[model samples]
Target: MTFTPVTPSDIAPGTTRFVQHEGAAFLVVRDGDGRVHALDGLCSHALLPLAGARVRRGHVICPHHGARFDITTGAAKGPPAHCGVSHYPAQEKDGMIELDLNP
Candidate 1:
């Protein structure tokens, strides 16, 4: 679990932010309730960026093909994305959001 610290101020509540670390792209999302999640930046369906997608009820809808993925478990919740995305462990501590980059 190699965690990388990210600035908490960079992520606004109820929005998804794109970040890159060690040549890997990750999507860091802060839900409406303040819970933060990190997942593979690309959608499983079309390999499109998930940062521009919409987050609704803990699921992220792929902007390209309407594929929905659960932010917490990275489960494919709808059509087009039968394969689930990768979910990384995330935590907030000391005003910083730390993500497990190796996960």
Candidate 2:
């Protein structure tokens, strides 16, 4: 996948934002340390939208069944979600947040 540009200001520190690229939904988050991460917007357990999912302790808690996934590695960190979601490489460039959708 190619790098898609997004508004950096839309995602604040310690918050999450939903973005669409090439007709696919993606979740972009800014950690407490101000680092950006990108992940597939759907939960692996039931394919539920993870847009409003809570971010705590470096994990995104699924709103549907309480599944938690690591923001950095996309690893499943709790029950009800044995499988992990997909993670994309993200970085800041030219005052924008760029995500590698193909990663």
| Top candidate by lDDT | 2
Mind giving the per-residue lDDT tens digits that candidate 1 earns over 1-103? 6778865646777788877777777788888888899888888888878868778988888878899989899999999999998998999878788888676
TM-score of 1: 0.87
Q: Which ten residues in a row have the lowest lDDT in candidate 2?
A: 1-10
Query: Against the hidden reference, what TM-scores do the models get?
Result: 0.87, 0.90
* Candidate 1 ranges with C-alpha deviation above 4 Å: none
lDDT of 1 at 16: 86
Candidate 2: where are CA atoms >4 Å away? none
